[model samples]
Target: MLSTSMRPLTAHLCLALAGGAFTCGARAQQDPDGTAVLDSVVVRSTKQERTLLQTAASIDLVDGQAVERQGLQSLADVAQQLPNVYFTDFTGSTPTLSLRGLGFSDDESDSLSTSVLIDGVPVYGNALGTLFDLDRIEVLRGPQSTLYGQNSMGGLVSLRTRDPGLQWGGSAQFDYGSGNRRRASAAFDMPLGERTGLRLSLGSEDADGHVDNRALGRSDTAGWSSRFARLKLLHTDGAGGEWRLGLHHARREGGNDFFVSTAQAHAHESAASDAGRSDTDYTLLTGEYQRALRGGQRLAITLGATEAHWNYWMPLSQYGGPSGFDSRTRQFSAEARLSSASAPVGGLDWMAGAYASRMDKSAPYLFEVPGYMRSETTARVRGATAAVFGELGWRLAERWRLAGALRLEQDRRRMDWASDQSGYFDSDGDGVPDTPYTSADRIDGLRVRDSEWLPRLTLEWTPAAEQFAWLTLARGYKASGFNLYAYTPSSAATPYAPEYGNHVEAGWRMRGAGNRWDLGATVFHTRLRDQQVVVIGAGGASLVSNAGRSHSEGVELNAALRPTAGLELRGCAGWVRAQYDDYVKGGEDFAGRQFPNTPRHSFGLALNWKPADGWETGVSVRRVGSSALYPDSTVTNAAYTLVDAHVSFRAGRWTLGLYGKNLGDAKYLVRALDARTVVAGAPRTLGVRASVDF
Candidate 1:
């Protein structure tokens, strides 16, 4: 039997499918040349540029124009339109992302299962702050370890920013919305010379959030403000050589009291006596040089450097006590590669690359429970990585192609940690601390080293133009790390093992005649050894541990149709079953339990229309299924649906738009730590935006 939430989604899917069938048959008889074809999207996820239709991997591409039109502000907004993707934003600095049920649920910055790339440079922590002036976003599903090394076991998100154009032009936009939200952005491009160009973009946003704090008598307790600036310079040598340099800086300050107890009657209401605060900032610099050689071959060298910092003080106890956290990270990376151009030479395509990176990080955490206890811990880590990777593709027959990729990687890390405990102690074991005590521990010169060989094989069959089918097998890996928040000496001394994944996937994609429609489906299965998971340790501290074994399997489907000129319909659905095979923690056996924070079902539908010149409208519906909040816990986040719509009018060089999100006013949980500590999702919001191009 279908649940109430599932019924609506099922109905929407059926209607979309039926409409597509009817439109396909009816449109086949019309003038094919008169109808516009779906635009072709070029992606560079595999270290090479290729059309999405020609790529032999499962990928989702989101256009920058669509992002602006629909007012998609963050990656979480974009995830709603994609299949088998989930995001949980626990705080401004800690965001958990998962693809195909493979990601960490807790606040572990060094153990991300999914990797986020900004212009080919990997980002260490959250990537939400850099969502401005984007050219496109490519989400590559499944493991990409063969090309991207570690931390890419689940998938990769690649964001490409817009570059300078040949002509001088600019655009400006302003937006106002609910909760006193305000946003302003501008982009300018200019030609410095015949062969050189430059682009600059600036944006800022501020909002008095929706959440109300009764204890503090505040209406917008979760408000936030952010600002970002980006600059790019492009120079062409006019001899098949080019040089590009980019600089980006972003900062965000917001309230850290987003979590509330689940027992509250309203998710957006809080009773905290202390209104917390958070601040984060990051700067990135990147440079690339590319040269074209003979025989359609190209050589490229890239360099990147990043520096980020985060600081926050949030209430951790019901008695209005605050806990403080501070983190700082720096990374430098360089890569050189050579690859064959888009046109295969002698029916063969190949690429080879070498990469090196160095990172330094330090974090300190202080937790206080008012008069009960206080613990402080500081950790410092230095890590280095080196890898060599290559990929080759061969034409086996007129309609068949075979490809293989391999990567040899080595990671080394050194750690220095210290922990201090003070305040009352439970000396009598009566669940009460009556004696005051103090203890301290230190760990130094601890080192970990890991080496892995990741490989992937794919067989593709192209039966017709714009049609492709492929099967792939790949291996993924994530390096080990120590627990930074450990309070006890034994817990601080322990380290988790590396995780390994074996994955298999099969997929098919096709476009209808005249490009009026398209359809794609994929099935995947993955098995993991020593899966990394978070567990509650002594003193109510969170620690990363390794699970014995686990597995995840799922199917994803997507379809799009243009029934008539100026009208389009799209739909996507996904189902996943992820469970543990053998796992025991703290004397509890959870062999067959489902993975936490992984939904079993998800679906989406969208309709876009252009009724007349200078007029556009669209609506989208998304449904997310229920899932457990923690391993072996009875508490679950219930299912919920969201609706978003937009309408715009354009005249001359000016455009105005009205958009609304979560129109149904649905209340849901985005993150939860048991029933007491929970973070609610955003509520309904409506806004208006205006933009002008010159």
Candidate 2:
């Protein structure tokens, strides 16, 4: 186990900064060529393709090369290191992301605060099983319902996979890592015919876990194996238009991420250490078309269909072992967008679009607990949503701009639950039966209907090229739904209310005189109404409820510097205060406490260098502050710092590399329940890699 001493790191950074070897403050992208010439970044995830200087929102980028150099395996690894964005996983394969301290909870019905998109297809909650074969990842933070609908009340995540270039090319990589881990990946792109191209990529990894399972006498209890493949076809017209068809599939089968609580972490022993299993399978199909119309206008359309299946089992009973669950989800979505490509110079430009989606889910369970609990049940649920949105930007003057957007959305949900089990003792109290819920029950066709309006307004001032300042206000929502599980005697038929948020932000962007330094900063505050919360009720059944209100305020900083040739330093940091403002739950007030899964301070820094001799090296350091685990829960996780380093050399078309992660081998908690159950993070890992391009 690594010791908790980070003082030396701080001293080292201070020395470097004092010597002018490192630069700090705010977010920016520097020249990759070791020159002072900076390049503009075009972002396509914010419902439109706009340059970073032009977009009035906070965004983070993890490009393909960075992905390879860092060996990023999951979304959690990417988000937590960005300024105000954070990611956590209590369950091994499920990823929960929060921006500016919002996302939390594993309950599926909470209405995902953040919406995920691959290419142009929306992938609700199951975006974690696959993070391979990508061109870039775009994280847009803040309320986004004005364009993405309710699911994006908090933010949006977009992942774009590699596309075949106009010429034929490909690359392949293989590596061996700590704990007998191994991975292999390859990609190819080629011209198929006139004006057409095809690309294919495949990746797989398997590893013996970091934790030991004493009860099972296994050194690698939480092992994992994951595989993903993607194929894409692109067609280009002579008239500056394009269309793409994509198919993606991924699978993960392995041990769950649960680890013994730090309090009981000795020898990695746990109450249920010997019996656990988890797996996930996901697939998506997407088609997108874009055309430049004849009358200085453009048209865009996207179509998507996705299916995800996941299951996990934990032997809750030491005697007869009773527990297992599986869930399946399918969704179809489509969107049509139109924008004016040519507007009068220094005048008005606008865009409009409509979106539609239908989703279906079936979650079934089978459990048997010797004499305590036994159940075989299923929750069948369906939901549909539709919206029309538009945005108009007016160049009020040479240096001023005004933009506003609105979305009218409607959503409907239906649920049917059936169950069969053992052990029930309904103690009648106040007309509600107490549990040891026994009996076979079936409930059908419970429904919920909701409608909401999402709106956003912004004003931006550009005093000089590559410099801008903006202020924004937005309102977003998360639709309501019938409970998937019933903790009460008969309230499974009732539904929960919707969750809403209003946000305000102000920020500035600037590029230093020589383009050698660039920075962006933002201060934001959000008011949350009807926050969804999951708690335990009668018979230890899970229940979903609402908190009256909460508030979040934070400042985000991103900065970069290219002091000399082949060297670049970039860092992101944020300080947040999140708490329930008004809380009355069951007539009990729990206000004045911070939210669970939220930290006060988060920061990350990285250095990239390619000195000479075909050699390249990089170092990254990140820290996440400690915080409570749940609302009103006493459990907590200690803050931890992670360090990753890599060294590689290129010869002709081949590259050889070495890498290591979590050098400190810190024993941090990614998840905790009560004070006795917690999940441990990955330990130190090292690897050697080889790659070649053709």
Candidate 3:
């Protein structure tokens, strides 16, 4: 697999080099821009926006130019090229992104370790990260729980979208790929008035799944389609007081596809051959205003509101006999923030803000046939936080710079549950008692309850011009909620305790002109308390509880070298040792068991060459290490590798591109566990795409 993955890369390099020589020879005759292109590269991995060489964090920033060049479809594909970043897609639709080894599963019952942000508005749902139109993606490793809050205890994925400037421009793209896949995307920025601008983006995609479903006489069951549209309006009074409003909407429809082995097919033959998939719709509106205070001070106020609705279908016949389950969830959130750029202390650039946020969630689960018994669940989260953050580039002893920050926050989460019928009702009126419904035995009736003070802090030190290093320590938390499906008459009504964590990290970075190369590495350890884990009994019932503590440590390396002016090479690799610290099972402590679904090793590399004659080409290769099932499963999947390539011809405002993804056609599982199993990463897909700018 590795050799095949490398072959396409080798071929692309030769083609790119040949193309570059011809283009360079012609370009030499033209005048060159004396201005340096330093701005083309960014350093968003860290909170501070410095050059890659100036920061100590191991971060990767994929800019809009790079995103366009690759014709990437989702965050998983984009993250695969970054060292220490791991991403997987169960279907072409859902992508799970993780930095270092701290992130792995996207279980609804588990807390998220990575926080995804869209245009500074943090998005926290399972669907938000799938949207593709973005200006840049910032992958910050280690604990960002302080600045980012909660799930960021592991890492963060912040996506910054394109801004509408003082120009009128727009771009549109269309593509038809293999397997009847069709896609279209377009965006425009125009002046609304004398001091106002408006920008809009729209995209739609549809494709057929690759897996074959013999029961349904179809070769595809994972097919999905999505549509997204967004609008932004900005107004500036030329006095540092600017107000902006943004509105966005998106929808997704899809199902899980897994090819079963011959052994599993003969046993009970329980599977969903014709079940509908999960569907979700998201809508949001946000506004922000900024103005100048006194004495070179600035102030900014931001307000946001969002609502998301999700509908999921579970084919119980696939699990047991013929049973069907459906769940609906509605979420609403609102937040306000006021920040100022003022420092009472000398040599400090400080920002202080008071923030409040509220979130409400409701979900109802019901049986499709027989006696429809409905169970309803709800949760409310309200929190207030006061934070003062400052980064001081203290120029001590010439080239040395020191930086540090502190954050303190408090959050309260409450959960409630109610039901019309116990858990199950005999709707069919059959004396045989259709299917044994969820038996509420030895369980406390569901009610409402609350939990409260999450806190965090960070510090960094850079020594001189040739070296940089930093150490960080922080705390993180995840609120607790009730599970309706896991509830019975004997179930406990009070919500479970929230998870907590203490994370520590240290790293080093070095870069210079010698080889015109940049390199960075980091090691981190985390101690988690009240870790949420699934508990099961002999009857195959499920419940969430504070199982046991765990520890994780990992090392990451990233390097980008410009061997020559026209050629650039980038490589990233990571290794992690994540395990249960004190987990007790079957009367013994399984302290060293590896975390389920967490890859031990992963790496990726990319090479891009720009030759003369408006031509460009690139190739990339990525590898994911093997992982095992949770709860002491003896089965483990082998590792897998993938390859991708791109070639484009550009002239003026028009460009034509050809791309091939998963070129080696490696067959591997992107996500797999009990409940719903998914297999086979997206197959090698080839397509031609065109883009025009005006």
TM per candidate comes to 0.92, 0.91, 0.81
Worst 10 residues of 2 by lDDT: 6-15
Candidate 3 lDDT, 1-694, residue by residue in tens: 0011000000000001111111100111121422112233444321323465454554556565555445556676666565556554433454656555444533333245676666555554455534555666667766663333223556777766666655798999887777666778899999977788888989997866565565676544666677988888889987858887888788878665442442332221224556445666677776767676666555555566666665654444343322223333332333332333323323444434444455555544443332533333332223333333333333333444444544454545444444333324355877544454553233323333333344444344555564577776666665564544443433334344666777777877765654456666778877888765544433344444554788777887766666655565666677778777777753556678776656678776777676666777777777777776332233355677777788888899999988887788766544433423334455677888888988
Instruction: Name the candidate that leads on lDDT.
Output: 1
Q: Point out the higher-scoring one by lDDT: 2 or 3.
A: 2
Please give, for residues 293-317, the per-residue lDDT of candidate 2 as tens digits.
8766778888999998877765443
Go through the candidates in order and give the C-alpha RMSD of each one to the true structure.
5.7, 5.9, 7.8
Per-candidate Cα lDDT values, in order, are 0.72, 0.69, 0.54
Predicted structure 2, TM vs. truth:
0.91
Ranking by lDDT: 1, 2, 3
Candidate 3 is scored at a TM of 0.81
Q: For candidate 2, give the lDDT of residue 287.
A: 90
Better of 2 and 3 by TM-score: 2
Write the residue-wise lDDT of candidate 1 on 1-694 in tens digits. 0111100000000001111111210111223333435445566534366566667677776666656655666766666567777765555334546777777442453555788777777765463643689887777878886444334878888777888987999999888988788889999999999889999999998887887888888876678889999999999997868898999888888886666777552458888776677777889898888887887787878788998887777654343455767888898988888888643423877889888989888878777677776778888888898999888888767788788888888988888889887889788999888999888889997888899998989888889988889999999888777766666667667776888989999998888986788888889999999988766654445656899999989988887777887777877788888889999987878798877767888877877777887887778777888887643245577888878788899999999999888899877766555555666776898999999999
CA shift at 202, candidate 2, in angstroms?
A: 1.0
How does model 1 score by TM-score?
0.92
In model 2, state the lDDT of residue 477. 79
Residue 202 Cα positional deviation in candidate 1, in Å, after optimal superposition:
0.5
